[model samples]
Target: MHLPEIDRYGRGHSPLHRLDPRLKLPALGVFLLATNLTWKLPLAALFLLVAFLLTLLSRLPTNFVLWHLRAPAALGLILAFLLAIFTPGAPLVGPVTREGANLAATVFFKILASFLYFISMVATAPLFRTIQAARALGAPEKLLALFLFTYRYLFALLDRARNLSLAMQARGFREKTDRRTYELKARLYALLFLRAYEETERVLLAMYARGFSNPRVTLPQPLTSAQVLRGLPLLSLALLLLALNFFW
Candidate 1:
């Protein structure tokens, strides 16, 4: 994984880290809006340039973002190539049609913007803070509840899988084990799935017994107007650049 999972995401020390997740979350949303509002490639490039600088300012290593980009890069390359071949617009080069290539370029930029926005958000905000911010931003209660359950259950699922794997190893099963070992592995996987399901059910029943109705995750108080005010300058600068791109 690009990050060390939950730990790397919650550094919480730098200025960017210390800023309210509420601000960070909206900043990312505005950034996305700006990214899409302009079709000018150079303008989008500038947004990316600013994002690059922010990553550095946030004290995250370049690879921290780049590592996460691997999946996006692969997906983008595939989609770009397919769009270049199939979609029609302008000729890119001799024999290769222009229309297809131009649309492909647009797709690549769109994907890049999405990837950068998502990865940068993940790198800077702790998972819990991000969830809290999402809730604060008026995310639906149903969605919030689902996210809460998912966050807790993911680690639980992983722990169960690890235990199952260890039990198999203890039984003298290795990759080189015979065909019978294959059956044993399948059974182990079945048992793991069953265990995870039961555990989730148990958790739900326990929560219900405890009067859990709405999601109960705690977040530090919502960001004040003054706190949000601090990011205004940079946000304004970003919006200005985005606007200029269309006219210039």
Candidate 2:
């Protein structure tokens, strides 16, 4: 029912936090692309280091950023493990090879670097504001609206599921490693999905009744010359990394 708080670090006074999302979004995109395109492991490490410095500039707690990377880091490690096993080259140790090691290291750096940049840019801003910025950059309005609504009300949907769970518990339902429990859980999930669909239809009808036909979406403020110029450094960094990717 109530909007959930998403901008946990938005209260900080960092320049990155204050940077216009319109500028920040594009810079983050270019930075992520450049970092991923880098083939050299050393260049990838350098790119990650730069992303870390940007996180520092964001003024979010250093530990918080690292914490955010935990899931991605775990997935990256798994990916690296698979790549090291599957990709063939001069044998290093057992099945692992020199090429695979290089490839794994590159994957690690790219994943960590991209996530760090995202934390610096997105975690420090209001999520809705960033979504708004996406619109300013010519993203599709209908898709954006669908995403924003889905994300915004996700907690409510989860709450509904939880309440259903509690109701089941009140009726003496006990979870166990049994076929019946699995079937019951599946049915519960199906019921939740059906409820979600019904809620969405009701929401659509309400919107139509409330004059949402041809709704006027609010656009972000226009950027000025100074604001546009201020983002040049980030753009330059992206270009510099892209150029480095071509070197020995």
Report every candidate's CA lDDT: 0.71, 0.84
Model 2 residue runs over 4 Å out of place are: 1-6, 169-177
Which candidate leads in lDDT? 2
User: What TM-score number comes out for model 1?
Assistant: 0.75
Best candidate (score: TM-score): 2
State residue 231's C-alpha deviation in candidate 2, in Å.
Answer: 1.6
In model 1, where do residues sit more than 4 Å from their true spots? 1-7, 87-95, 98-101, 163-192, 204-214, 241-248
Worst 10 residues of 2 by lDDT: 1-10
Residue 92, model 2: Cα distance from true site in angstroms: 3.3
- How many clashing residue pairs are found in candidate 1? 8
**Predicted structure 1: lDDT:** 0.71
